[model samples]
Target: MAVAATKEPNRLILFTDAVVAIAVTLLVLPLVDVVPEVAREHRPATEVITGHQPEIWTFLLSFAVIIRLWLSHHKAFQHVRAYSTPLVLCNSAWLLAIVVLPFPTEMVGVFDNSRFTTGLYIGTVFVATGLQAAMYLIIRIDPEVASEDTPLPGEFVLGAVTAAVLLLLALVVALTVPGVGYWALLLLLLSGPVEWAWRRRHAVAAA
Candidate 1:
């Protein structure tokens, strides 16, 4: 008799998707309190919208970042056949940071001038990126969990670690240079493309 081959559910991917969706939706919840009178009295609807503009920027940036993070995780995890307890726990830590981003976004919008506020926001992103890096390390150590033919790419691993380190550095820089930190966010947003470019350059050189 042949033994049955069981398929493991990619629970991390599913849970991450659910949490990201909820977090993105929660980002908009802060805007619901701007009543009609508040809009009219504060300024026109447009100005009121614009006044809370940081909220919009933060929400959009955070939402898109979270979505992209999930996409990357999904791609990376596709190689994995099973996850260990530590990997799952590290992922949860990452998700905790993701879920907490909204609080910092709201705080920054409320007190955009506060240095500590910006630090907190950047710190949250740093923590998320760090956990993601940790997860990658665990996956690399246990290639047996990965698909046999889909060995993790060296470029992918390098890129993940580089981006995580850059994010951590950006968090530290944010403490002194808040404006630079915002610009760094734009740079961090381009990590995927940067990683692709790096791999392409290496391939061309090898050829």
Candidate 2:
């Protein structure tokens, strides 16, 4: 049988980091453009920030989201020394979702809170989180990607899956619940407890 080829993960990790940095930076450009308008109107410097509260809020939220996603990606790949074709494809799709996040984030500030805008923002997050979860699962199952001596922890895999599930739940609540808006994302807080319970249950079962 012909063995599949695998390469070191360094270049892939570097490229992913670069793309995530650019995406996070893009989230702030809309807010920066507001400064020129504030100056052109001879408005007080205070208004430069105070008047663009929506833009600023969206920028901060998306910045945090991207950062969290990047951290998750980092953790998922931490033990992965080799990259297969499937892992590369999955990581590329995850990056594409990260790149697209800034657009909906900008729209959230420009448009009134509604089903479509809320859905779009939450949906983008859902896709990104879901992809990250898939990466965790892939690394756990693919012997070529992670060394047997340093396999991904079952808790980390469960946490990633739990987070993705919570994000999906948040997306559904945001879309179906009237006036919920971004508040639906609070559902993510349950991820810790949920993952804990799942892990504990499995441990007990094995015992």
Candidate 3:
């Protein structure tokens, strides 16, 4: 029986970075459009920024979110030296979610906070985080994908899963609770402590 060939991951990593750059760039386009609308309305020049506070805020928020996600993706692939079909598919799906995020981000800025908008925005984030978690898990288990000299850390694998779970929890809070809205995303901060505890527990076990 013939074995499937593995390919170097450099091109895949470069492609992922390019897609992430485009997605991050797309997040700011709506804010740029606001400038023309303000001019047409004959409002004070400052209103271009001051009047569109919601849009500005959401753009900043999404920018931070996309950057953070990209950082996580970079971390996940840092130790990878090879790739397979499943890894490619997983990464593509993650990129698709990243591309879709700007739509919900715009919706959040334009529409009043509602279950639908909040759910949609948080849900897109959740999907992206979940896909990243899957990538970490795949890399951890697949000997063909990661480098033998520098193994992927167990904390990274658990941290990705922990972050995804927090995002899911945040999505649930945003959907079910009125007035909570995007504040629900604060749940994601728990990931650091959770991952720390996991590391401590494992260190004790190893000791």
Candidate 4:
């Protein structure tokens, strides 16, 4: 790797962090800033928030999803340690997906019961996770963009792939199941155990 390629790309990471932070912050505006006068006058703000329980749930779920994505990005970039045209392009694609999340998130809040919104939300997840997975592969292929002798941690790549699979499975269940629909997205909580088992097995193997 050239000396330039080995240098840390702090600006890239900083810019990406800002973008992700802004995207996550935008999630709250639809719930609070856009309250109608009717909602404002008839009830205490607390009560109004309570009444919008489903929206709160959607907000939290979307929030968690974005945070998961950030962590995956963080993991991959630790190995990245540099930059390239393909690497920058991959990062841009991933960030594009991140920024788009808030719209579908609002749609989830507005159309909690509608299959279209739910499917759209899941579709967003599919695209985002797919982009993230591509990022991992791109970094691996372009060693000049990575730390010397470094490969992405297996657990990290597995986690990203698991997320992609989980999203695809959620979409399938949402479409096929009679009543459960997008509630299948709650299945993402299962990634906790999956990651735990992945780490446990890798730890034992390393030992």
Instruction: Give the per-residue lDDT digits (tens) of candidate 4, residues 1-207.
Output: 345565576888998999999999999988875467436577666765667878788889889989988987887888877877666777788888889999988987777767787788898888899888877876776678767767776666677777888889999888778788677877788877988987898799999
- Runs of candidate 1 with Cα error greater than 4 angstroms are 1-7, 35-43, 178-181, 186-207
Pairs that collide in candidate 2 are none
Backbone clash pairs for candidate 1 read 81-145
Give the TM-score of each candidate.
Answer: 0.81, 0.95, 0.94, 0.83
Model 1 agreement with the true structure over 2-39: per-residue lDDT tens digits: 11112353666788889988988898887776556466
How does candidate 1 score on lDDT? 0.74
Misplaced by over 4 Å in model 4 are 1-8, 34-40, 189-207
Question: What is the lDDT for 138 in model 1?
Answer: 72
Number of clashes in every candidate structure? 1, 0, 0, 0
Instruction: Provide the global lDDT of candidate 3 against the true structure.
Output: 0.88
**For model 4, which pairs clash?**
none
Judge candidate 2 against the unseen true structure and give its global Cα lDDT, from 0 to 1.
Answer: 0.87
Candidate lDDT (C-alpha), each: 0.74, 0.87, 0.88, 0.80
- Write model 3 residue lDDT over 40-119, tens digit each, in one string: 98899999878888988888998998899898788878888788788888999999999999999999989958789999
- Distance from true position, residue 19, model 1, in Å? 1.4
TM-score for predicted model 4 compared with the true structure:
0.83
Among all windows of 10 consecutive residues in model 4, the one with the lowest summed lDDT is 1-10
- Candidate 1 accuracy as TM-score: 0.81
For model 2, the superposed segments whose C-alpha errors exceed 4 Å read 1-5
